[model samples]
Target: MSQALAHNIIAEADYLATEERASVRHELVGGEMHAMAGASERHNRIAGNIFFHLRAATRSKTCRAFMADMKLRLGQGALFYYPDAMLVCDPTDDHPHYKQAPCFIAEVLSPATAKIDVREKWSSYQTLPGLRYYLLVDAERLWAKCYSTNATGQWFEQELSAEDRLEIDCGDAHITLTLNDIYEDTGLLL
Candidate 1:
């Protein structure tokens, strides 16, 4: 969604190595390093709100929620990205630098990233194993797009508007959140 570092293809090893030393965050997709643009205040706040809700929902379980700083690796693709927020219930997903077993991922869309997020990233995330849900949040409006898979692993999408509550059913752990939960203090509603 952000700008690619260059037209050149960067090896996975180099991308990971360079990201550690770089000040800003970057994503590696199709062997290309794309420098992530800074999130707007609304974007950060919305992500924070989701993290808070998810963290609290999974507090009693083995699950944990992480915000933007944590990197996520796309299994088998050698692509890595920073989701706005993610929820992981697998204790075995304890990687030193990145996670691979996130059951849920949320991306708060900015004008610059919306197209890529909806098309490219959406296609990629759908192929992940055991990924229960993917959420796309609107930074400038009261809307959220939900892509969720069923028990049979078929994907379906839903759109929530205004104060709609999204129900996330991950069997043992369930989370229900409304627009007010994410847009509360972000001032995006105004």
Candidate 2:
């Protein structure tokens, strides 16, 4: 959708509400609140695969893995967003309201939302304090790009392909997996 159209459809006067009745997550951009869309088959598969692996690896620890259903309150303007998969090592995130601390966040791109995922959402997620790595899993390509926060407060990116393995450090937890493990059974785009 065009920026002009988005601005027109979402008016500037709709930001007065403090809360909503239902559980629908609304993303606010440029004073417009855009309702999040549902996930596709490929999105579900990628999320499930990632979550399964992470859960198994971190099963014995206090760290936990959450799927798309859980809500992540990234910021105040952005009330909620459902990530494809997330890993939180902080024990405080176990609260009922929403996960406040996320060590790792992943979003599986789709045709309709690829631009938002890669651009707008990426920028917003990078600003989170508890976030260490933000991963964008490509829908068309058999690759993923991870943005890690360096000590200098700058983001360092690493691209992982079919030939590479992913090793992520989440504070108290460490998890490693190969591309083959994530794309098992399901045919990957590579």
Candidate 3:
């Protein structure tokens, strides 16, 4: 969530309509619209790296990967968020403007959104029945955290450094990502 546009509550339909024509992006949360801030170069690079890997990994499979421009609808449209990167495998979740269910989601943390991403989004995302993996990547450092659900529906956390490789199982396909792949061309590895 970003900064609230105003104290007034906006209807979901109205927010969607306004967002369609609005120059800037806004997320609807608890009936209030919050204006999203622009990302830094480093943030964009990190997010792009994640998206690139996810897209390639899911290309031959039924899954599709999306970047920040795609909105993820939650809480029956009461909460809408734009994740840095996400993977959706369910064919029924084909909304033109937003996604209702995602199997995997990644958020690259920045100074402004780190707290909300770690606390608010983390809490909300876990409530989704189809969500199996949630990744939090640090933009300023070579660190990542992954929360994955097991067969028993219990969630476990794993912390990764530059040398670690992350393996994700996406039903029919499995994808592996390394810090070198994520931080490539960002000058972070240098």
Candidate No. with top TM-score? 3
- Residue lDDT tens for model 1, 33-125: 888999888898999999999988987788878899888888553789899998888889898678888899999999999998899888888
Candidate 2: C-alpha RMSD to true structure equals 4.5
Instruction: Provide the TM-score for each candidate, comma-separated.
Output: 0.90, 0.79, 0.94
Cα lDDT, all candidates: 0.86, 0.73, 0.90
Alpha-carbon shift of residue 129 in model 3 (angstroms)? 0.4
- Cα lDDT, model 1, residue 186: 84
Clashing pairs in 3: none
Cand. 2 Cα-lDDT: 0.73
Q: Candidate 2: which stretches are off by over 4 Å? A: 1-33
Candidate 3: C-alpha lDDT: 0.90
Judged by whole-model lDDT over C-alpha atoms, candidate 1 comes out at 0.86
RMSD of 3: 3.8
Worst 10 residues of 3 by lDDT: 181-190
Question: What is the lDDT, from 0 to 100, of the residue 131 in candidate 2?
Answer: 86
Q: Which ten contiguous residues of candidate 2 have the minimum total lDDT? A: 10-19
Task: Between candidates 2 and 3, name the one with more favorable lDDT.
Answer: 3
Largest lDDT belongs to which candidate?
3
